[model samples]
Target: MFLNKNRFFSNTDLIGFALLALLIFVMLPVGLDVFRLNLFGKYLTYAFVAIGLVLCWGAGGILSLGQGVFFGLGGYCMAMFLKLEASSPEATKIQSTPGIPDFMDWNQIAEIPFWWQPFHSLTFSLVAVIIIPVIFAFIIGVAMFRRRVGGVYFAIITQAIAAILTILIIGQQGYTGGVNGITDLRTLKGWDIRTDDAKVILYFVNGGLLFACLFIAQIIRKSKLGRILIAMRDQEDRVRFSGYDVANFKIFVFCAGAAFAAVGGAMFTLQVGFMSPSFVGIVPSIEMVIFCAVGGRLSIIGAVYGALLVNLAKTTFSELFPELWLLGLGGLFIAVVLAFPNGLAGIYKDYVEPRIALIFKRKMHIDEDVSKYDPLEAAAD
Candidate 1:
């Protein structure tokens, strides 16, 4: 009887595990196709942004509109390193000539900017991907949280930051690669990105990273810190009066989300082999919020599903009906909000899981009440 109960519980977990495995198996074949693989890779990168937004906005109750800032920081840092590495050694020797970069040449820059000096090494660039975003978030989070600035004010401030960053990158053409951004990346660690093997490896890496993010988010959600975050979300004043430092908690999660966004940005740079200023603009940041909302703002799985679905639709519509793609997307968003305000993930939780569980239970005769024959409860057996 104990064994039977154990099996029943294991079966429940098994179904979820099996579904996840099936998803990975199916994606593998799709990712085998070079074009499809690249597109999926981009989806994973966007999912990363969605995950960060879910944590900050969904759990922490902090609606951050400037995740793009960190995303851009990491992308630009990686792009700068790749650009420097790909540059001809002869180009490096010219200190005062127009050998800084093509955009710099157009801007009449005779030398590399002082700030662009550290991006020469791939290692430094990788470190900066995480460090720069975390540091920036720390400063910004402290400043705003300490002063108790939030709600629409916080959102507007973050949006302004994103706008300013975009303009700065566009204006500083010499150092930032200007409006064109950075491109023409050839190799990553001696592996040709154009080759099939490299593409496959990147696909798996992206998949693994997405799973890791989900797992970590799950752990955080189950932790005490997560509870506090949720409490602050529901009632900040109550949480504060309960002797908790709400600002510190908000800052911690905000920085964590920023770091995750940076990771996504770096991964995106690797897959696309380019970074552009447009990626960190206000529009993209707002889109991140929409992605989370459409996915189920509070659920990590919902975020991933939403990112993949939205991007897939984007790809399909762009190819099939280029002119109407944006309209189609807008209509889809409205439909989701009106039909299922909780998003796709919520729909699954409400309508799908229960049916699945019922089917499984019926198939396994779970409701048969075999306990009626329990030997332990038998009289003088």
Candidate 2:
């Protein structure tokens, strides 16, 4: 009975999945050029984080301001493995140290750091991409939720963590590639990812992974666990009094959110071909939250659209009106907050979705009326 209730697809799920399929497989591919499609691919990476925020902040009511930290961690882990492969002894003969990365050699570090040694194993890095962020989130969630620390205090702490991590990455120049970040990525498993064909393949792979996450999210949203989260969010004391371990639920959702962000980060590295501290900083972390807010924090499907539209606007405005891009972005955010606090998804739910539902209901009712009234049809049957 539990399994049946948690079954993957509902009526709304089918519609949501179909629209996503049309967008990913048909519309974007047919309409956009290669370069533009690739840019949209980049935007899709952010959608992963935005959707994660939907689970963490929207449903769970845990507003993590340090999601970019997880995203950066995942990207950097992938970048490290690629960087090691790209900087083989044969490739670095020009440098003083033949086997080490160029950045290390440039910064006068003769040997690889102890920490970086593990990234040479691609398998380890792949596991670390998900595991590391999950671990970090677990630690943070346990510490904060157990102590009953939340709201603005939790946000401030996460923001501080983002600032600290960004500074550390910049300060550890030799170890981390410093401000330049881990670049010069060439191939993954001997196949050149820089090629247009590879980009297309990666984009599809990304879309598949995203849909997988979305399905998992839908399952969670429809399950008892998801209800517990919403209950904890709205009435923590009532939940705790009912003998539910509230902290555990918070920690689990937070870690899941972190894991999602990390996958997005890894995908961002693959699609963009670099990972940098710029994305790990306070500004980017806060921007990720905005992506969720603008999408309708409560709507997972809306989150994807929000990320795509916001990034599209950013790219378009930044190119055409470089001087006024920030101003425009600020105004857009202000408008979203003031006019539609629930976001694009809320608007759709309140207005557009009702009309669509009415049409379907009318058709269904007509079919029912015909079956009831047509005595000749019944006799034929």
Candidate 3:
């Protein structure tokens, strides 16, 4: 039933996006202090991951449980560049090896690793942030979707990949900084990112990038490829038999999702000042999926809201009631599942939209009757 649906943006979509723009660019910035605003900026990074999930899981029916893998990869890429810049020989003069990163010097590594060399160039790191995730996602998508392996099997495989990456990062202390992960990141290209001014600037940049992703996702969701994805989700066998290479489409969308996530990761590194395996593991990956589900997997805009609201709640609850925070989160998840499967967007679609449509219909009917009854009409004729 949803396959033939092509209406991209109703009046509802326009209004929703407008409000989101206002909230991000004006309301939050005006209402909050620098510290609080920076926290919101951190939340906005997660919105990138949520937006990706809207495309891959919502529109394309690919439930990837390892989004954090891409996010961490992108963040680590950016962090490596920043780390190198911050670890210049002059900056690290106190260390025994005055040119290497602090962690490496502490770990007694004699020289920079070969793989870390590429990240010394900002241009290369930026490209790698997007390309690396796309390649990794493409490999996984091809392996699974080609053989018709999907559903829960696909989810499990993605989760396992997340686990393996976390383990590897933790094990390679000499390379990855071990359980401590990457820390002490201070500057970017000689600019002090820890300053209040930089924080505000980064927040705006993060918001701008998020909206760009949203626009791209909307275009994809309304295209012919989008319809086919829905078709495959509902009936993969039918789509394949109809001569479509379903696997190829799945790979494309999954890679697209990973790219979105990579951007978020890089932004997280810039704004939050570190990258760690803590973000690339099972807990974080699952939480990222929850953001999409709560936002309404089918609705791109809703996913953004879902991420912001969930993260906001997590911070507030954990701060106010540390012991009860998990309880609150569990209840929130249950409420979303049991009460609103379609999420915030579903509520708008079912209740709010109908009222708006009814008002418009009534206004049109009144205008038609008034036109017919115009007394000046006869005299003019």
Candidate 4:
């Protein structure tokens, strides 16, 4: 009966399905609690960023060091809308302070900047979260990929972009919120963001989004485009010679990855209820890369696991040994890299595959002996 089923339901598929089901079941209960739920939501956001890294660095061999730029762009977009909604009607009319955010006061600015106008609408801000990062990535990808820039050169360029973005945000005191980024967010769509129910709902939403992303990533990994991406990663010059537009592919993936980061950023803003220039700086960008590396860059599941594990450790270490948190994290990274260069996913594979293979081998040996030896021969032996 089992043999009559579709071949696609192999051992790996069964195991994967079982694991996913378990994860959902376990998360459902934890998500019911506000604090744990919020923590999980944060992890989901980090998972989204890590997934973007998986696509760019793992699949495309493009190490984007500026993912935080896209993340910050989306975060600020949502933050602006929230701020606009939170402001009083009378406050919205004053030219200098009209719908002016609190940060303007810190900068001693009297009026709202013209550029902050479009973000007044929730719809526009949401749309911009997806669009702005994509557009930025498209332009950057075209320029760099067209010039055949990659590897360390590509990484360095992206890092510079992140650094510059951070500086620009800090310098643009009035508009960009300067050092003390957008804060004191009270609500979302009139719902008290600080309430426990809202937090649980957010957690469920985050879990759903994480699952959806995993499904989409799995589909992409199995599709023809995924194969092409792997081909590009393995031999870009050969792929170009084979009539494929390598530049276009690279740009597409970059833009897609950026969009993913933007989504994560928007969601993160909702959970954290604030956006800061520091969130988009070089250190955060590097941290995103570290999440992907610690997870297993090539595997989406690995990325999720890595983000959760790393963030959980961060929280624990910070609570228990605040001063030693960075040291412990650094040591953890070094240990993972040395032990399983391919990341935590590799460790899982190594542990599972050999055990499964051993079981199958033992079963096969038993069957072979049963078939080869007659009852009389066995008795004589």
- Best by lDDT, which number? 3
Candidate 2 C-alpha RMSD relative to the actual structure: 6.5
Q: List runs of model 3 lying over 4 Å from the truth.
A: 1-8, 360-381
The lDDT per prediction is 0.77, 0.86, 0.88, 0.78
Q: After superposition, how far is residue 359 of candidate 1 from its true place, in Å?
A: 1.3
Query: Worst 10-residue stretch by lDDT in candidate 1?
Result: 372-381
Taking all chains together, each candidate's TM-score versus the true structure is: 0.87, 0.93, 0.93, 0.87
- The digit string of per-residue lDDT tens for model 3 on 198-263 reads 999999999999999998988887788887888888788899999999999999999999999999
Rank order by lDDT, top first?
3, 2, 4, 1
Question: After superposition on all CA atoms, how large is the RMSD of candidate 3?
Answer: 7.1
Tally clashes: model 1: 0
lDDT of 1 by residue, 187-278 (tens): 66556676767766777787777778766776666567877888888899999999999999999989888887888888888788889998
The deviation in Å at residue 151 for candidate 2 is: 1.1
Candidate 4 lDDT, 218-277, residue by residue in tens: 666556676688789989989999999998888988887888888888888888788898
lDDT of 3: 0.88
**Minimal lDDT window, size 10, model 4:** 372-381
Query: Residue 372: error of model 1 in Å?
Result: 21
lDDT of 4: 0.78
In angstroms, the error of model 1 at 198 is 2.0
